[model samples]
Target: MKKILFAFALSCIGFISTNAQSLYNSNSYFGSSSSTSISSTNSSVRYQQGYTRKDGTYVNGHMKTRSNNTNHDNFSTIGNSNPYTGSTGSVAKDYSVGAYNYGSGKTIHTGSRGGQYYINGNGNKTYVPKRRTRY
Candidate 1:
């Protein structure tokens, strides 16, 4: 029993380590970084040498700055803002979503024994049963 348990544990650890290295260290999958280049002109978004300077987005067929890192206030330019209700102009912001971190959503996890686990609607994580084949 001890030997079987130890083998299982080692197998799980090996699997996880290999997966992590593949995901994070595999530059070949994402790109070599130096081989990739990007350029844009007459573009709503602007970047200089990979560093983004400004970003604009089109809404309702009109281009507007998506960034609020501007010099002046928009108190007078309310007509040119996003979700611009004509009364309150440009809405340049990264809005935070208001919701619970964990609710009725299905949560996935790895079982302690190295199998897959998923959360039940009642918020309890249950391990998935391993598949068995008939002899």
Candidate 2:
């Protein structure tokens, strides 16, 4: 009967959707798919949009921001050479920020500004400057 056939079709559709994986998890499909839609007439305003994975990783995109104000900021600091030693035969602070490890036999200092400083074999602190953008 028509009613039975309709019920079967609906069940099939539900099963398929339940078993199907999202496009991000699948590796075979490649094409443009709009994740979101916007309706605005202002062309001068910049819109920032991007996608992140389940692990907080972003892919296949760029971000843009528009601001009407600009200001210059200065940061200065001074510190002493109170080097913290890591435990022997173990890696300290290996993965996270402000981590130290003695398993590698090195003292690493990570900066929020994105470059890493490490102590060399001779116990010398090395400072590596990050690359600057050209505007």
- Candidate 2 lDDT at 109 equals 64
The alpha-carbon deviation from the true structure for residue 16 of candidate 2, after best TM-score superposition, in angstroms, is 0.9
C-alpha lDDT score of every prediction, in listed order = 0.37, 0.35
The residue pairs that clash in candidate 1, if any, are 78-89, 81-90
Candidate 1 Cα RMSD after full superposition onto the native fold (Å): 25.8
**Candidate 2: stretches off by over 4 Å:** 22-135
State the displacement of the C-alpha of residue 113, model 2, in Å, after optimal TM-score superposition. Answer: 44
| Candidate 1 per-residue lDDT over residues 43-128, each given as its tens digit | 12211122332345433432233334331233223223222233453322111121112222544454565444467766666543
Clashes of 2: 5
Worst 10 residues of 2 by lDDT: 71-80
lDDT of the structure predicted as candidate 1: 0.37
lDDT of 2 by residue, 11-51 (tens): 66445433442432344443457444321111122223567
Clashing pairs in 2: 90-103, 92-100, 92-101, 93-99, 93-100
